[model samples]
Target chain A: MAKQDRAIRTRRMILLAAAKVFEERGYQAATISEILAEAGVTKGALYFHFKSKDDLALGVLDEQDSHFVVPDRACKMQEIVDAVMLHAYRLQTNPMVRASVRLAMDQKAADLDRSGPFLRWSNVIQQLLEGAQARGELLSHITPARTADVFVGSFAGIQSMSQTISDYEDLMGRVSDLLRHLLPSVAQPSVIASLHMSGSRGAVVHEEVERLQEHDPSALAVG
Target chain B: MAKQDRAIRTRRMILLAAAKVFEERGYQAATISEILAEAGVTKGALYFHFKSKDDLALGVLDEQDSHFVVPDRACKMQEIVDAVMLHAYRLQTNPMVRASVRLAMDQKAADLDRSGPFLRWSNVIQQLLEGAQARGELLSHITPARTADVFVGSFAGIQSMSQTISDYEDLMGRVSDLLRHLLPSVAQPSVIASLHMSGSRGAVVHEEVERLQEHDPSALAVG
Candidate 1:
């Protein structure tokens, strides 16, 4: 069990290093040697976990699976809001998520499966909207799948614009504004009136996710 | 007169070649030599118009200034819709805009003015929305600037998503869906009911722009 834990630790370390180097230097220009130096691990140790440069990139792509539990809210629509807010928060402060987004969006790194994150995020939104629909939270015209696509695309664009304009420092505000413009068309008036669309909600969720993680270590274990 | 015309033609050729190269190789990896080869111009000719590869990139950035005159409609909100639909149309078919968007969004190309286009686009929408407000075409609570920002960000995100998922084959549909979701919050019920949001609007705008340009060369001369 101890040996298994050590292996997981090494893999995590390697992935972090790879994420940094790949983001800074790009996948084509980034080298395994640089990753090794950044990781402070031997080539033998790195190779034990990742077989190639592509393997290291795949690991980083999967590294986007950072889990934090948000307790059930009164409105599942609010949970949808919280999910995006949490992601924006992490995409701002979390190096791993930032790197993954960069890698996935990089046209130069076309070989990487960039669609995985898009699909996963859309799925998350779809699930929340489904719950909203079940509980009479959304409008009659709003379809979960289609709304999910819009949410995914809009968030991707907002974060991207924020990244370009302000390095995501203003992403929370932009995202808040986005939801304000969009949610009226997606949710019922009663639900829309109750939802929180503040950019600062990210910071709140960030703190909450952190608190939850400390309280229950297993809470962050998302697939 | 002959010499001046030659210079103009050479400059246009170099800009097109540079846009193609930048789109394919990105700013960092793109080479002057590749651009020269693509343009099929001499080194001296290329250098005569563009001082450096960076200058060539700026030229491509400016090349996105394609102008088309969409005729005035009953609803100003429809004009905003037409503008985005037209842009989506142009973005699908126009190589220069694609390259410019790619260049502006490339984080590695941090040396370039990334926010220039986003600000320009948002300003366009803001101006339109302000007009809509004056005419009472918009919702009472909507702010032009914030709504414009959301419009720019959402379109960008949708376009990017379409590029990733379908290489923009479904861009028009996605954009139509986007405006449907957004216009309700931005426009009055009467305006929203009258707006024509469709994928084919792009091709129509493209033809209109072309016809206008054909009749008046100055029509395309946007700042």
Candidate 2:
């Protein structure tokens, strides 16, 4: 059991290091040697966990998907807001998530299949939007899939802009502004009014997710 | 005058070659040797025109900003739509414009300053939105600068998403959908009813710009 725990920890350390390198140097420029140096792991250990740089990149991308969901909300609109806010918060605070986003948006990484994160995000948001539509929390003209694409694309652009502008220091504010402009067109007025579309909403949701995880580790499912 | 024309043509040819290489290989992977081969130009000619690869990229980035503007419209909102639609049309049809956009969005080009396009776009859109507000074509609560960021960011994302999904074959449709979703919440209902937000808006605007340019060479100033 102790040996298994050590292996898991080593794998995580390697992933985190890869994430940092990928985020800084981008996927095309990042090297396994740098990752190994950063993680202080042997080449054998790194190879044991990830066969190639591409595999290591995929592992970092998968980190964004593992076990961090926003806590549930009564209103589906609010749920969507929390989900977006939570991501923006994590993007501001977490290196792994930031690296994953960079890789997914990196057009220069011609060898890497960067479609996974965008498609996965669009699908996840589409389901939540469909649920919102069923509950009439959204505007009548809102098509779940189309609106989902807009949300995903806009968030990607907004974060990219923020990264270029302030290295994501102003990401939460920009995200808040985005939701403010978009939500009015997307959700019912009542729904929009009730939703917390503040820059600080992310920090609040992050706390909630953390508390939920502390109480029940299985609460990591998508909110 | 003949020699000047020849110089201008040669410079344009080199820039086009650089744009193509930059679009395909990105900034870091792209080489001056490749661009020279692509341009079929001598090393002396390339150096005479561009000091370095970075200078060549800056030249490509500047191409997107040069002299393509929508014609005038009485309605500022329509003008804003036309500006966006015109750019979308160009992105779909023009290789230089597409390459410039790719560079602007390429996160892997750490040495390249990608903020120019985003900031310029935001500033342009902000002025248009401000004009719309002054003309009472916009909603009462519209904050021009913030809303401008949303438009710029959303458009960037939508185009990037379209590129990833279909190589921008469906960019017009996606952009039209974005305007449809966001316009109702932004403009007055009457204004929204009067605006053109179709996929074909881009092609129509493209034709208009072409006709205007042909009629008066001096009509290159932004609308």
Candidate 3:
């Protein structure tokens, strides 16, 4: 068990270093040597975890799905907002998420599947909207699938704009602005009135999610 | 005068070929040789038109701003819808526009300015919204700048999703869905009712613009 834990720790360290390198230099330009140097690990140790730079990139992409944990809400519309806001918060603060965004959007690194992140994010939003629809949280005209596509697409665009403009400093505000414009079309009037959409909302959601995770360890078990 | 016209035609041919190559291979991997071959021009001819691949990419990017011509409406909100739908139509059918979209979103092409498209799109939307607000066509709480950011971001995200899922075959429907969801929040109720946010709306706008362009050549003189 001690040996297993050490191996896991070392793997995590390597991934962290790789994310930094990729984020700084991009996927094609980022080198394993730089990643190893950054991690202060031997070449063999780096090779043990990530066989190639592509493997390291895939490892980073895989990390995109983890880390977000928004608690279930009575109004799933609000829960949907919470999920998006929490994601925006994480994108602003997390290097892994930022690196993954950069890697996913890097059109030159055509080896890995570019569609993975979009599909993953689309599914996440679809499931939440599905829940909201079942609870009558959605407006009459809203379809979960179409709305999911739009929300995921819009969020990706917003992240890109933020990346180019302020490097995610205004991501929270941009997200708040997004929810304000979009939620009205997706949610029932009562639900819309009750939900909070603000630039500062993501940070608030992040704190609430963190508190929930602390109270219930099961919070960390989300896929 | 004939020589000048031939020079313009040669320059246009090179840009179109470069856009196609860049679209297929992206900025980093796209080659001048491929563009030259695609254009069916000699190296000297290609060099005369564009000094480098970067210049060719910029030419492609600059052309992204053109080819959409929407006449102003009594309610500027309708004009905003026209602008978006016309863009969607162009994206579906025009190779230059599609290639420009790919290059603009290619995060790896960091040497060229990525913000040019976003800023241009934002400015277009902002000016439209400002006109709408001046005429009282907008909702009371809407701001042009914030809403412009969302529109540009959402449009980009939708384009990316369309590229991944169906190579933009459903881009028309997706843009329609986006406009429908967004218009209610931005426009007054009467103006919202007047808006045509449909999947086929882009094609319709394209036809109308073409007819207008035919009647008055100055219609194509937009900067």
The positional error of residue B85 in candidate 2, measured at the CA in angstroms, is: 1.8
Model 3, span B1-223: residue lDDT tens? 6999989999999999998887677677678999999999899998987889888888898787855468756778888888888888888888888788878887667677777888888888898899889999988999899999999988888887777766788888888878877877888888888777778878887887788778865654242
TM-scores for candidates 1 onward, in order = 0.93, 0.93, 0.86
Q: Lowest summed lDDT over 10 consecutive residues: which window, candidate 2 chain A? A: A65-74
> How good is the docking of model 1, as DockQ?
0.68
lDDT pick, better of 1 and 2:
2
Candidate 2: tens digits of C-alpha lDDT, residues B1-223 = 6999999999999999999888777788789999999999999999999999889988888888665576767788998898899899899899989889888888778788888788888888888888889999998998899888889988888888888777789898889888877787788999988998788998988887788788974654473
For candidate 3 chain B, the 10 contiguous residues with the lowest summed lDDT are: B214-223
| Every candidate's lDDT | 0.81, 0.85, 0.80
Model 1 C-alpha lDDT per residue in residues A1-223, reported as the tens digit of each score: 6999999999999999999998878777789999999999999999999999999997887667545356567789998888888888889888999898777677656566667777777887888889889999988988898899999998888988899899887888898889888888998898888877676887887787778777865544242
**DockQ-derived CAPRI band for the predicted complex in model 2:** medium
Top-scoring candidate (DockQ): 1
TM-score of chain B of each: 0.90, 0.94, 0.92
Give Cα distance to truth, residue A175, candidate 2, Å: 0.9
Which runs in model 1 stand beyond 4 Å of their true positions? Answer: A66-68, A216-223, B66-69, B216-223
Instruction: Sum up the clashes in candidate 3.
Output: 0
Q: Best candidate, lDDT-wise?
A: 2
Q: What digit string (tens of lDDT, one per residue) describes model 2 on residues A1-223?
A: 6999999999999999998888777777789999999999999999999999999988988887565476666788888888888898888888789888888777667788777777888888898888889988987877898889888888888999998878899888889888887888888898888878787888988887888788976655563
Candidate DockQ scores, in order: 0.68, 0.62, 0.52
Model 2 CA lDDT for position B12: 96
Best of the two (1, 3) by lDDT: 1
